[model samples]
Target: MLVWLSLVLCYLAFLALALAMPRHHEQLRGRKPGRGLVWLLRITGAVLLGLSAWPALIWWGNPAVAVSSWLGILSVAAFAVAMMLTYASGWWRTTLAGAGTAAILLLVLPVFLHP
Candidate 1:
């Protein structure tokens, strides 16, 4: 579903943005991230967050509802990411991998699965 995809992408975007910071990266990886890596994470996070809006536009086909839905999805995703960082920091790596795989699968599967 577009809603689910948007939520996952938003969550991933927030995770990437969080990990771009030195403290969070160090917390999760046990080492500071390089400048290049930080920049990459930042750009990737921004782009993914932007991409998450596409499904809403396609599904809703109305600017107002689409914008509101995207905002709601972002809020839920941000809260989920904050909770993960606060309470489940140890699982960051696993969560990142799983979310990345899920995002890819969601993007690809619909192409083949659509009637």
Candidate 2:
């Protein structure tokens, strides 16, 4: 679960970093964040990304297995978050709420449903 959570958080961090960019101001709210905000997003995103390895390491003893599993899970999680944010943002009150719900269901449902 931590692994999945980290991937989702990393994607969210990516979105934050993207929104912090000046080019995204119009799409976001016609407002650009200050340099400090942009730096915050960038640093936070990097830190969240780096933390994603913890769960993988705990689950797999081998470095190769841990990294490979992390990469695979990260790829799927990133796509799920990105797609939900891109299309659902216009449909819901908040993109994070919509995307997060979808991601939680996709990644977490099976764990409880079949366990």
Which number leads on TM-score?
A: 1
Q: Candidates' TM-scores? A: 0.94, 0.66
Q: Model 1 over residues 64-95: C-alpha lDDT tens digits? A: 99999899999999998899999999988888
- lDDT of prediction 1: 0.93
- Sliding window of 10 residues with minimal summed lDDT for model 1: 98-107
| Model 1 stretches with alpha carbons more than 4 Å out | none
Q: What are the per-residue Cα lDDT tens digits for candidate 2 across 1-88?
A: 5566656666665666565667653456557788898788788767766766776787687899889988887787667656755665
